[model samples]
Target: MALHVSLIDFLSVIPRLYPNDPDYFCSLCLLSTSSLCPECQHTHSTHSCPIGGLCDTHRFHIHCLFNLYVMLNMP
Candidate 1:
């Protein structure tokens, strides 16, 4: 028997290693050297917003994140 992988699984597991757009700065509050979120006290080096890819370029407090999703018409 052979193991099989789904397309969705492959897509989901791959991280966005390279920044695609220059307009979109790192959402994480980067450290002076490395990409890091100062808000999280640099605990999480990259802060991909919970809003999925829509607001990945923007970082917010928990409340702000919720409001932004609503404003942007994202579920």
Candidate 2:
């Protein structure tokens, strides 16, 4: 049987961080080289959901998370 999931439930599977954590790397960009680079800092500071982390083994920026969510829900 096929399994169906709601957007809220699907999104809940992704991990998120609040107050900003310096140790967590971006899931989209696994490399620590740009975890908190200047660009990321600017995005985080300017964006609503500034901080985000991997749910399991994937790290990503807050914006990336939103994009992922949209992509997954796209038709």
Candidate 3:
């Protein structure tokens, strides 16, 4: 069977179910942030994606810089 539990619904019941376990938590939700859950489709910023935080936009920039550095060094 498959279970679909929204982050919002799951977080709500956690406090009640485990009242004494205040510190208990899921890292996925904490590590991954959305506007408020489902409202914004979980994209934090313009360059961010729903799954990967910062959609590798910076990696390409770094690659370009490296290429430029190599080109400038070559005789």
Candidate 4:
């Protein structure tokens, strides 16, 4: 499914939760991004779900992400 928001929208929400020093793994997906999810989509911010928290960085809407995860049998 296409995302409702753009990469910029995702980036706008990330910096505050993570360090913005341009040398950290993307907080949103455990990837390399100074400020953006590796797979950008409007997802739960790091506050709502940390790296090891429920619904972590999977970037679909909560319900949608859950459904996809189930469909794919992902952890």
- lDDT (Cα, tens digit) per residue for candidate 2, span 17-54: 42145555444555534435222444434455465555
Q: Output the TM-score of candidate 4.
A: 0.22
Which model scores highest in lDDT?
2
Clashes of each: 0, 4, 0, 0
**Backbone clash total, candidate 4:** 0
Clashing residue pairs, backbone N/CA/C < 3 A, model 4: none
lDDT of 1 by residue, 1-75 (tens): 323444455335424632445455554433322233334323232345332222244333443434433444533
* Weakest 10 consecutive residues of candidate 4 by summed lDDT: 50-59
Q: Please provide, for model 3 over 1-75, each residue's C-alpha lDDT reduced to its tens digit, 9 standing for 90 to 100.
A: 224555456435534543333354333233423332222333344343322221211111223323434554555
* CA shift of 74, model 2, Å: 1.4
lDDT of 1 at 43: 26
> Cα miss at 34, model 2 (Å)?
4.7
TM-score order of candidates, best first?
2, 3, 1, 4
What C-alpha lDDT does candidate 1 achieve relative to the native structure?
0.38
The candidate with the higher lDDT, 1 or 2, is 2
Q: What does candidate 4's lDDT look like per residue over 1-75, in tens digits? A: 444454455446544555544344433356423233343343346456433222233233344434434544432
Q: Roughly what TM-score does model 2 have, to 2 decimal places?
A: 0.42
Candidate 2 colliding pairs: 26-59, 27-59, 27-60, 28-59
Q: Name the Cα RMSD for model 3.
A: 18.2
Model 4: how far residue 42 lies from native, Å: 14
Each model's TM-score, in the order given? 0.24, 0.42, 0.26, 0.22
